[model samples]
Target: MPDHPVPDPGRSLEGPLAPVTEEITAFDLPVTGTLPAELHGRYLRNGPNPLGLDDPVQHWFVGPGMVHGVRLRDGRAEWYRNRWVRSRQVAEALGERWAGGPVHAGMDFAANTHVIAHGGRTLATVEAGALPYELTDELETVGPCDFGGTLPGGYAAHTKLDRQTGDLHAVAYFWGWDHLQHVVVGPDGRVSSTTDVPVADGPMVHDFALTERYVVLLDLPVTFSMAAATAGSSLPYGWNPAHPARVGLLPREGTAREVRWSEVDPCWVFHTLNAYDDGDRVVVDLCRYGGSYDLSALSGQGPLTLDRWTVDPAAGRVGRQCLDDRPQELPRTDDRVVSRPHRYGYSVVTGEAGPATVRVDGSFADDAFTDALLKQDLATGRVEVHRFGRDAVVGEAVFAPSAPDAAEDDGYVLAFVHDPDRGATDLVVLAAQDFPGGPVARVHLPARVPLGFHGSWVPDR
Candidate 1:
């Protein structure tokens, strides 16, 4: 299952993955330092914009889910919106209308990637099976949310929020499903629990690892590609070295015959920087992609380190450990230590990579961006970098917790930076124990927040 070739769909969407065409909203924006009057609310990001910025895009995660908010309160940086998750083909490609709800397996498209906020709503997720699009805390588009209907299936884009029983844990998958479900949404948003599990080459479970007893499941080696979805490929998943690189665990109330698989060694995890339950062993930590899409181009794959995985279900074994070999990816920790034990982790800094860069107008761009912003320290391995140089492009950094029992590196880290010499975009922040210092605030965003994928500092609870 390794040589399926066929990936070249053309790539370039102009500049930092360009795609902004309107939908502005601005307000009291401009700020530079000091903004933490207990740092109030909305940082909400979610990407894959693409409402046809000159067409040609078979996969940059299949565009069409934009959402870039920024609100704050006491110490104000107040408003700065940018919606477009209308879905139903972005509301029929903007002629308007659809924004309506309930479209489970029939998948109403665009929910971009991540923009969480459990029970009290505010979601916009996306993954193999799509079905979450409820925004509206100023981001509009309140539509597809199967939870009230109890969500029987389809929904995922990384949803693990169990700050101790507020449950939310997702793991859905569906290239037509040969199994892999594990939902759990309770906390009043519904879908109490689910379990499926099966498997055998439908893999692409993008992200998973939530430990307060286990839900880990990352079957690895990419998988799912009906020949790149019959070659139209809007992200048809790839790299299937015969699909057998396991790690299942399951049992946070168990089922699927109680899960527990364990085999590891073929890597590919999109994100996860936290997981815990030591004792009977569970550990996790992530962002290790020794391979991906194989040229089915997600920046054409590989180069991302910082691993760790213990799993040891008594003796079933799964021990990986490579804590930091540089090259990084979008990890983040401290959503109140999601799924438990965490000692700080945050990433962004995909430097030293190569692949998707053929722009002499022949298109194909995505030279990784992200010039620095890490903060590891997973119990004393200490890493704190914060470079933002090479003209700045950084993306996912979210941490924001100076209270509600603060003390885990105690405070802010936010991030949206993209200051290619002030062409725009700021929102910086960073002061979690002042690691690489400078920038206790920055806000200044009137536009250009392009480079994305995963965000939340939602607060205002």
Candidate 2:
């Protein structure tokens, strides 16, 4: 570790993206507007909060994991809490022992990308082959979970839960491995199956899409680089033009050899909106970057837009057409309709128009902050935008249905929005059908929540 453990003065560390210092707990939060009487459960989001950076240069994506959770029940905001996932280094930094069990591939870093509840447990997850850390309902770190010792390898930051089968599916890639591993955890909280799909370069697979008959893999251009690793970069991956960009459709119940590879243009995808089987073809909607991981700039270059890829196995090609050219990321749809045809989708419009640049003192420019949320009606090609005022930052918007049999748009969209005016964060709830009509309720918090990755609305069953 470095002597001071301070972040290098070349990354974004100010404003809403700034990291918080300590854990906090607040209760009986004040709320504005009417709270839904039927809404019950916790809204949790995970993101990087660097305890200390030992590396010479730190990427914004590689910080230690911290989870912020707000509990709502019976039309009232009950509590809000934040806790760091207790990896060995994080525990030691806090003067506590590591709470997790044995790790795979010697990678026990913080699981700081997203959090979800499945099979009666809460798990904080990350990417690039880190095991998931289990947390209690109240946000206490329980330790790393390998599914009762049944998990064969590392876990992924993004896992898709099949509403029809009650199974969770993930695709994981390790730097040392030559192939990507597809893992399935059954509804019973155990690993049911594993399959290895070989590839050329060790591409950075941030997220994958799951459909009814296939697990979609994005083998893009960004890949592992030894030079970046030796250059003291915490995230040792960069854009590789030589590595061909392609998408793979692996049979849901078949081996790697059954995967049909379809060629697409060179691009990078960090998240997928959703995927579904359209006849014999597969349709996937995702946020696509023109390129990613500019090693010199240490940021992504080019505009990001929502694009749809139609994989035609009969033609051995993947066709892409831009649905919306607006710059955005972190797309989400109704989780229940994941891997199936549906209508409504939502995303946060990142204001960054080009490659993001950081200041010499590690501060980001004003354009780096996300300022609005948008709702897209795929059925009618309608889009609604909700601006959270200037300098306000918004995280991912997760949809929770009003009922088990609720209509596709009959739900609430929940997100954490930082209000520069109040200098605090709020859990803003908007009616899915009436989006852009202002939040129905804003549960104010005691502190600010930095802009983060994906999260889930864990409804009480």
Candidate 3:
């Protein structure tokens, strides 16, 4: 796994190989055959951007919201952290939260710096770095203990920080979803190194997990993105993410051994399940299968139910042994959604659906969409979908770490919401005791965030 230098976009697209706009439509969004923009103002928007939750955070998972790198007094904003804003120098790069994006695209707006917390206290707020987030808790941008490698940048496709080893892990890819880039960051912000691995055939590595010993990934291979940029094409095609999907397991150390990839179709590669280690075996709940479908045809379609798969970390053995023949489905409105592995075996995601069909072009072709507070039982493979009845679109959700002596009633989930239809997006809170139902609260966001890629609760550990 060698790094294939990402060629300059202008140099790659010229002559006949240039990407045609028509061809790019396929690579922009996944899950085709829905509907078109005819539903704009009615469902989408045609006005002069009436909603002013401007430059809000896009796709993400949640950590408690903090102010000035400190936990804030208000609940309206939990830090929904991800790679929406990075230091990439590419122009065509599309920002938003898709696993892959336009050559040079992004926003300078940041809601709250993505921070790691201990209960209600702030430990670190790392800006997007090539390796894990920078340890901006109390240091300069450079020098010792700094993540200095250059990541894909532009709202990086995906990232994961291993809880076991405290090694920050991020995923980077050039194109064709065939290659894998793993960046590890130490607690001091010092980067280990970057390594290339095999990925399923798609444009993005939809989701990934980092453990004390291994790095697991679900690669949605649409690898031609780099080739398209090099050729100066807006839309890069001629790639197949489904020839056979793969789940990979790699050693966490350097040039790890037993790196393996297997064919498996995960439904929501981006908005997916989490991986947990049970000692004797490692368990991962995979939301199988995704694509870059046309939005014009696939509007009005609901969310696709996802199958849960459990994998063996040592042997790379995979099986859909947990879910039913049909998986549980979350609401498919336009709100962003995210999930984290639960303590026992179940997983919880805070999300909501909207009436709008305008989703950001995430890292993969169909990388971006919306969701609700979804409660899933991995063992029996049952799902509970929580819809936004009050017209609220739940954004990122995380199971706040529970203290050893913490009361059960004190246990809760933290989240954010983006509701453009009502012209509002807010930070929110839900009690896990009553999750998928029960009591909920909303905090008005200081601004609107579209959607983001990967994030974590970083419980008060």
Candidate 4:
């Protein structure tokens, strides 16, 4: 089967998308419109930021992780800060020894893909590697966390929280391991349980899904390849037709040995919007790609379409359908509605073009370079798009509830928009109820925040 070509690592580091060289902070950012008085939190985003300009990492995902954050309080944009996660590799690159602690043998640490706040601690995480690194509310590195040395192994970049139980769930896959571990971290920040699920090949499980009764895992065709590693490619995983494509549904309180695996057509899903228990079946909404990903190519594939998969555990079957044909990714719904039927979902509308040139990745490059924001009403089958026109690009729009008890969809959408024309970036806030009415406010940044993977809104307590 034909696969997409590899992306040029050097070219990925050029232009406005290039990683920042150093960390900096700015105070009292300018705003164009009135800030939301109810919005009191920090908008923090994480991405790969190499330690040196000449560092040669073949894939964009492997660079050192850095975080950019903007603090908001009482309708004021107080300050902005960017800092490296200070992983062992990053510390070594900076002529400093790893001061965090002794990492587990065979664990690689980057912690660059995502940043989240849980159990009164902020963490920077990367999948399939070392333990999560703790960060202060100010985004300073507190050190690596092993949940007081109780965490069994590496943590995943995408971990889901149970609103009712305050428990965190994750499925973790190591680089060469044939088995994946289902880990549960309790509300008090300790590993509650872990179950090892065996598989034929080590597939890259970027993200998983959570329902009220089940934990959904994707075992796709992308598998670890010895040939790719021997060839010195930075990303050693590639498409393998021999690998079976399936989804596993494990009961929330059950072990992996009790998992029911259902077969689905060969495809790849990097992110899951939401999943819910539909009586006897489980319904999952995600951004799905038809086949395997080409780690070498800049864009990867043509486009990822929003898809819905209905998994019937009793029949061991997965029924799939495309919800929308437009190229989009980074699907997010209101956190309060997670693991339940949700009415609204939002994603960045990615296009074929990059900031100033065509992206080498066969698909659109990053959410940060997307042309618009899309809001989908699952009940009405209606799609509303907020286009930024030609030169402006937007990142993931995280939904911020107006209050602790705000109604679903009664909130604001926050994202960072980079305008190439101005050579600057802005924190854009949109009223969720009013779809395409333009930004309610724009907080200007002194420098451009490069396109990145994931971010979150940490409300001030």
User: Number of the top candidate by lDDT?
Assistant: 2
Show where candidate 4 strays beyond 4 Å: 1-12, 95-97, 255-257, 298-303, 352-368
Superpose all Cα atoms of candidate 4 onto the true structure and report the RMSD in Å to 1 decimal: 5.6
Model 1: CA > 4 A from native? 1-21, 28-37, 40-42, 54-60, 64-67, 73-77, 83-205, 208-217, 221-226, 238-242, 248-261, 264-273, 283-310, 317-333, 336-453, 458-461
Better of 2 and 3 by TM-score: 2
Q: lDDT per residue, candidate 3, 72-141, as tens digits?
A: 2222122221122222221123322322222312322222233332222222232222222232322112
lDDT per model, in order? 0.79, 0.84, 0.37, 0.80
TM for every model, in the order presented, reads: 0.33, 0.94, 0.56, 0.92
True-vs-predicted CA distance for residue 107, candidate 1, Å:
27
TM-score of 2: 0.94
Model 2 per-residue lDDT at 264? 86
Candidate 2 global CA lDDT score = 0.84
lDDT of model 3, residue 249: 67
Q: Rank the candidates by TM-score, best first.
A: 2, 4, 3, 1
Q: Give all candidate RMSDs, comma-separated.
A: 21.0, 3.4, 13.7, 5.6
Candidate 2: C-alpha RMSD to true structure equals 3.4
Lowest lDDT 10-residue stretch of candidate 4: 1-10
